[model samples]
Target: MRLTILAPLVAALFIAFTQPAQAERVDSGVPGMLFDHDVPVAMNDGAKLSINIYRPDKPGRYPVLMLMGPYGKDTTMADAPAYRTSWAKLIAKYPDLCKKSSCRYIRFEAPDPERWVPSGYVVIHADVRGAGASPGVLDPFSPRETQDYATLITWAAHQPWSTGKVGLLGTSFQAINQYQVAALRPEGLAAILPWEGAFDQYREIAYYGGILNVAWQFWWEHQVVPNQNGNAGTPLIDSIGGGKDTGLPLSQERLKDNRIDPVGAFARHPFDDAWYHERTPDGRRITVPLLDVANWTDWSTQGYLAAASRQKWLRIQTGDHLTPFYSDQALALQKRFFDHFLKGIDNGWEQEPRVAVQVRHRDGTTWRNEKAWPLPDTNWEPYYLDAASGSMGPTFEAAAPAAKSWPGLGEGLTFTTAPFVNETEFTGPVALRLWVSSSTADMDIFAAVRLIDPEGRDVTFMGNSDPNVPLDLGYLRVSHRAVDPANSTAWQPFHPHVAAEPMTPGQLYPVDVEFMEPTSIVIPKGYRLALTIQGTDFGYGPGAPIVHAKDYDLPDDSHSGLFFAAHPNRDPALYGGTDTIVTGGKHASYLLLPHVPPRS
Candidate 1:
């Protein structure tokens, strides 16, 4: 068979990717950063958003670094066994990670006052609206909420301790909201530093591809429960208010008028329409200077890879979503960026490389710098699928096209490559071109790229939401496969998700599925790379620790990290049927990888 011949060539050509020579490390340390907790700012629409100001104690005017999100501004930093373990792991690898104050006072995702305040910057944190001590309804990541961010940014620039220059900083909710506000181009907004934030509401946040995601249901319910200003006897609000009322004394009946139902809205709109578009940013309109940060291991990996702006720089790290925001190297980069734009410091930031990346190997990760992303010299290699052998190789014969089917809503088919004879590495965006047919009118494709060790064990990484997760995952609703040629590249395809084109049962349709995260994986000789085509997340087990949204915890913290909701489409009647993948000849299917050739 043709498969037998190509396997040897694939092994022979497999070579490890190269790491870049080290670049100079930049650090700008100051005495300390200070703060003023629970400051309130009044919005033009007569809403009050809670704010926390962190600035120099010396009282001189300075540029403001503001973070606004649905997470309560009053949340405190505390110790946990897991967090302590993460800290120990980080410090053990990089001893200088804590060279300055550990910035221990910094809450989970907000800017650390200990670092920024001492560096001639004022760090501000605020509860957007309908959350924390802020009064109103909880309509998160909405246009109205985004406008409120702009209003708050303008408010900080005029403060007595502010220099009238402002920049945005934070992670997840704090970071993603900047895309919306930046498009509005608020006055005094100098730049943004969005770390692992989503810009597309439909594809990035609520729905993956077109199927509804229940992975964040528990997080969604608990994050806003305790922090509502009018809620009676909530510990966080009560503590901040000294046992008194936290905000305007609106009755329970009146307070109910202020919130929007996110889950209900999701159910009402199953497709990407005006509702999702309004929340998503207009990328073309975002012209602010950007220091967009992303991690190789997060769900928000797509946002960072697709980040676009006139003056933008990217910094990619290797860790879970929250790690980059807390790392010492990351903080140094953030301060250096703010210093140049906000304080007029001649820090030579303009001369810095446009892209800095962390290339991950199983043994360890190496840092590399480049002038742009997707390395200009990249050799885009395609590995053809051989359905008969359940494997991937460099070539396949067209005479015998093959098809395989599996339960549409269960563990689906997987194709693995043979053990490598030499070390091989994969970096950058990955694309799956498939010739698929579903027994039903529509199908959802969930594709995952996995690492297989020499022992045949799966090598996992820390995902944005869950620990011990696969290297990368992507999804596509077959009907939503129409591409936006104007914005899409060969390596990364852009699907508009605007209209659905249903398929006739058993009719093969060519579909492009884009894996959201850009990854760097090094496979040693005797190791393999596997691709799983499934309808759900690759699971570890039922007892895995649940990861929730920021500040996501129950009142009693009992079911704080639980995932309770099920996907609406994951049912026997709705989405359970056979799905087929065809390969060879006109139905040529392949995996597109960004293959970086090793240095000569």
Candidate 2:
């Protein structure tokens, strides 16, 4: 009886292993459209990666638009359970999302094949080395992954029914890798569009001013791990056929062994080092034409300015990161860009303005085109801080030195400006200089620029991910305050973050904090601009709480999902002490803002 029982179980396992894998051919549900899934492309190391192709059924040769990322290429927007809420909100806000096509075939943060294929383009999506259907070790944005992306680009260019030119398109993760691969200057790469993606891995995301963003732990556990290759119970299933979208299943222990722990890596390396340098893009090496789209409240313009591309354009828009990329207006802009660069259509794209900004006002936003960033005629003005009266103003008059103190881990201080007498527009980078002292050896400073209405209500806007966000934000750890003199500018201070210089307790030191990203706001008459200097993460107002990383806990009174700088491993003895800000006479502290003048 024991032999009989064992024989059946062994037979079942043998049969499961003997069956051939299913072919990935399905009707694209669109006239004259062909869908080819799981096309293999080999790397130099003999590792095979998979890609999905959507092209016109009668195509001879066409320019290619590609997206390569860890997000599953096989997972459709309508079928992805993880993005259910985001998809619903997208549809509710933009009902015309399906007017061009059913929108069922569009992958998350990727282009809709139905929209591009009919317009004489071949759209392709690839599963990065160790995600989705591809099988390998999972390491995101690694040098090895960048190499594989370059290899894929060459492969797409030489395909039987493809043009030699390929253009990169997508949002967020899809866009982040574009910068890295483009730096390689790979063959057949015609152009790139990096939208709302950070170029500096260390400064922009992992460690904001030397303070670790623990929310990355949540991002890895929730968004990335579930879609990792060989994950056993991935919720993402093939929309055309009901089955797992990832590869064969692996045990939880095996899965853990095959991937790098991003959070653990971040904890080990607190400074900018070789590990981050290997992952970040060297913009000087990127020579392809570029169209960099930045959200007004999200990423910065550093990457755009660093690129060596002579034919480059910048468009700054106001909206959450994902919505604007798929809007009808944005879609048209992308098509026109690709049509000129990839197809050599001569669509007058070269004549387009170098900078396009959607200037945010009290009621809404307005469009403005300029020849360059920071507006050539910008008036760099200093607003002096007054510690005695908790006020900030344009003029600086000598007065007796004064100081204000607050708990290091509590709501610190707010210096408000008198209500404006005229409509004032602040349309560029911002910097904050402060003379600070801590009771302990070190402290962290969190600064935010906020708008106050005539009725004293705080004005907020929808950020990249969070609904309620301030005008702009900056952070600095007093210990890691060394600035790179070569890169330091009046409008922006570049921190090398190479070493930590612990502070002498109660000894005042001046630190300049750059607001990393730019903002465009028009303050109307009777409105006040306030700067809040705090020790903890900026709190969110009443609205839908940041749901993306809600599982992560914050400090007692602080609540934030994005731009979270509260480190879990920080020592209370070192950072949880009283903090002081000094201002007046010799110790002058002020906020530097870029004031743009009206066009002639």
Candidate 3:
């Protein structure tokens, strides 16, 4: 939290990177970016709403870069883990950012107008009603709140000196609302760059492959929900934003609100009903020119920029978490997109290739560009899970198999292979369909799809989250697993976790899990695919450690680093996710991957 000016002189730093004529600190005297302010706008339903504005300079007309999220925009992110991660990264990486821009004057990052101002961009950061400075009961991305966003845009476009042009940009929640508001067809909206925004609400949040992403829920309840307006964390009549705290507060009575019940809600419905569909916007409605960005190792891969590549003009890249945004190469790409779209300059960006990917390999660094996603002519290979023995079954030679289980009740079934002979490349969506049963009403079907080399070193690489955890893995929950047939294609089945149907203790039911759209990893010929099915959480290293979140502890952390909060059985055999097993056949289960062919 030490604010250091990278440049010795404020006067010197002012014009160092500018046109020299009129560069200044451009101060609004707002101590922190957390200001409770609002500009009333009209919604489609004739409802008038107010939005908080974070500006580059007060009372000036500048290009607007707007972002919205569940977090209270009226409060600064300086104290939050999510904001801290981005701030520490941004401030450290871009020393010039602290002084060169308004990073030192940051609050909630994506919506911080302070940072954008030095770059001459006006940032309209708002608290969704029921969140921060805005008024209304918080519903958190519900259909009603979305209307407020649409109205916010329409109003922002009409302000004098506005030029009626607006640009949307942000990551995660920030990136997501851009799509939702854009879908509203706000007239003043010009361009939007949504980075790694979660498109599928169910698959990304309520459940990851059916298993509830406990970390996400934990952050929501503890970190985010606690800090909203009217919460103990916010101020009432503070002169911040030069106004009163008008926004509604998050309900202390969460059960009465009924909107944030992650477990209870997800446990009720089992389909991609109107709720999920309403939350997700069709990429087609987003006709305005856009630049969608995705991280190679994003922690919350909820709002992944997967289907985005199919859009005409999207930009994809793989970087270590926040590196892409901080690094020179990626920033250059962002500048190009902004210059072309916002500045109305001919940056020659259109001539560039559509997909700018960091094609990862089993080795260290990897980068590649392409004109399309899942590039045409991709090799589709299927690796079957043969249950009779502990090897991936041959497609045709395998005879129908019966049920089998791991020794302990919750240990899970493991399948491995002898090392490969050549460098094999596998990428894209990896799907798993299993006819599974559990002794309890509900169970979590965990999968560890790994790449092992010939010597069996167990290939591991840095993931988007904790660098300690390996990247090659995905998970799912059986009760929350319900696929959207419309979105489920040949290679992957996108699950809608809106509802839950707990498992039959001993009856078979189909379980579909969608691994994120990953890279084409070239595993040497001697390498193999190791899929381990468990009844618990994943481990980072041997002896297993709980994959703790930057925020909350998992439900149950008792079993080998696995945090299980739901319920615990006293007897090891009764509650432990032991005696887990796997079975494969025409009607049972198997691994369905993009099985890419070896490229020249």
Q: Give the best candidate by lDDT.
A: 2
Better of 1 and 2 by lDDT: 2
Better of 2 and 3 by lDDT: 2
Residue ranges of candidate 1 with Cα displaced over 4 Å? 1-35, 79-105, 233-257, 299-308, 397-399, 542-565
Q: Can you write out model 3's per-residue Cα lDDT over 353-436, one digit (the tens) per residue?
A: 776555556555566666665566565565666666777634522546667765323456777655665666665656677766
What does candidate 3 score on TM? 0.76
Clashes of 2: 0
Per-residue alpha-carbon lDDT of candidate 2 for residues 165-240, written as tens digits (9 for 90 to 100): 9999999888888988888766779999988887888888788888887877776877778889999798878775
CA lDDT scores, all candidates in order: 0.69, 0.81, 0.55
lDDT of 2 at 306: 76
Q: Model 1: per-residue lDDT, tens digit, 1-600?
A: 111111112222212112211222212133444545565566666666777776676857889888886656555433322234445544555566455665444555777677667667788778768777677777877767877787777777766777889999888788888877887677679988888777677776667676665655554556554556666644543323345224655666765676666766776777778888777776766678888887675544444444456678887776666655666767788888988989889999989888888877765678888777777777788878888889886665442688888888777888888888888777788888999998888877877787788777766655554545566777888888888889888877888777778889989999999676677877678978888886555555544343322222212121111122255655665467688999888888888887787755
- Cα lDDT of candidate 3 equals 0.55
Which is the winner by TM-score between candidate 1 and candidate 2? 2
Better of 1 and 3 by lDDT: 1
Clashing pairs in 1: 137-258, 137-259
